[model samples]
Target: MMRSGLLLFFIGLAACSPPVTKSKAKIEEFRQYLEKSRTDDGVLLESRMLAGSNGLVWENSGKYQGDILLDDSQLEDLVADFAGVSNDNNRNAFVVANTRWPNNVMIFNYASNEFNNAQQNAIRTAMSWIEHFSCVRFRWRSNERVFVRMTGNPTGCYAHVGFSTAHPNRVLNLARNNHCFSHGVIIHELLHSLGFQHMHQTYERDSFVRINWNNIISGQEFAFTRFPRNQVNLHGLPYEYTSIMHYHNQAFSRNRQPTIVPLRSFSGTMGQMEQTSYWDWLRLRRHYNCPGAWNRNSEEIMKKEVERTLPLIKLNLPAPKQGLFTDEDNAYVRALNADTNNEDIVNEEAMDYEDSDNENNNFNEDIGNDNYEN
Candidate 1:
């Protein structure tokens, strides 16, 4: 009877699956949101995206291939003080400080006009889920000096990564659409606001995944970045492919080919928006130092929910450097995209003059992104 029940459950999970789209609209919309809302130039930075699906497969935000969310103002003083470590070698020297909200609380105020009743309820529901899983608490603002201004801009979705003592009036923008309303997508952006970086940007990500430079859209190579060993801290957790923080495997693809290829073999899903994966909740707990916030019973329930709701991730990754294309192939893709074929070329010449600390902090505003659904 138990075996039959499990089989039936698995079959049900596979019933509704979303196919991958070509562009990164969620990411682009985040950028558009920042641009249109007159966010600080410090928050407005370079961005890239491919077509996306209404399904919760791919999501993007500017800086480090749509991973980290906050701009310079939202970063810690350490980042602002370091300013610039100019070139690639210098870039390696800078590590944006790992930041989290003090006292494990994130205060927010939604612009009354940005969301309708349904959208507002959806946002609150996402907040409740985060509160349910970890020690992190979300509260409405009464007079907190530092708080997030949740806006309903028509452009895209974005959030300040972590607590910003430097900039108290931080923003998390989600447009009115199926894209921003999906619980998983809301959770993803909220994680960013909570200071969680993208999974692929982990310092050790190179060991777990291989990035195909040639397959990425030309001149948008900055969309994919591997953090230096000392820059990012994972709170002692291993890489998690299913974290809400993960970008889709096909993110930043240029010719409908995957830019990031995993190295392990797993017959389960990689990116799913159904809910927070086990590792995601664990990391959130670790970062906030929230001991015993999530109990074993909660874990068991969520684990089953994830397995029963998400598609099985069937990953047959190639060994590193095995059957993987190289930077040399980027030349062809650049030409195909009508982009400069030179891999050596750096897109941001202005970046060369700026300090490394400020480079990845700018953010994009959200624009209308049709590639999302419930």
Candidate 2:
């Protein structure tokens, strides 16, 4: 009777196991992109993609910062390919899939128990910060094949950016040896999973800060490269230095010297992760189109915050290029432009944030661009 019971359990397991969705092998252009991307370490490894800027550094699959499971291409490379392609079908070859999670809901599971009790709690609290400010929600899995798999490994913490319906499910690893358990560190990794990039390397960053090549570690210089403009849609935001996503002033330092210095003389901490900055919440709210953003009663309060934020450093983008926008893109731009100048709206309002009680407020059109100030 015991043997029969065991046999029944085995059959049930087989019946419920989800089948992997079949996808074709990598495209030839992707192959070439990888070939062009070779580093001294050889082909860019599968996992250690930098959190953003198309990830310039290469690490073994065991290590990484990129959020996409597959490697991301530099904007220049993608733009070049786009210009050369006359065949409409080939256009799909370079298409950047929609990386946002479905319905602003993130489903996840644990793949490893390497996290100490504190580390586990760190992960939970980080998720709370996201929920505290935006409409996004995090849920544990229950027979959900499409979900994030949090793992505690010896390798550095890294995550595949965004949701992948085509190949759902991925690992978000935190190394035990690394300070991956810190509240800010854990929050940084989670933001990548939610589709954010390093604050410093976003496009049009030159106007805000200066990158000191002489101070960066020799081989790791590529880590400081800036992303191209127009690739990342800011949704009408301006550059910000206080964002939790910004890099530390001494990051990747070979001699403990500053690698990034602000162009203007502003005094404040840089690359901090203790908690999300005020603008961080605004960007999160705007990016996901958080349903109810600010209470109308708070409009005057928001205006004050806007006045305080407007004079800060910012990188203003030119109007969208003609012929570049899709129909949907065109519509989004039209409505957004119809509202007001990106910086003006950000400075004028957008301070109101939703609480757990589900406060209803108008989307303030507050804005901020990703920025680095380490």
* Model 1 residue 159 distance off true place after TM-score fit, in angstroms: 1.4
TM per candidate comes to: 0.61, 0.57
Structural RMSD, model 1: 21.2
Q: Write candidate 1's Cα lDDT for 94-206 as tens digits.
A: 33333567677888897665666556655665665566445677788999999988875544566666665655777787756655656677787788778766777665777
lDDT of 2 by residue, 60-168 (tens): 2322212223333333333333233333243334234555677888898884444544455456656755664456778989987778888754434566655667557
- The models' CA-based lDDT, in order, is 0.50, 0.47
Report the C-alpha displacement of residue 333, candidate 2, in angstroms. Answer: 25
Q: Candidate 2, after superposition: displacement of residue 186 in Å?
A: 1.2
Model 1, residue 282: distance off in Å is 0.7
TM-score of 2: 0.57
List all candidate RMSDs to the true structure.
21.2, 16.9
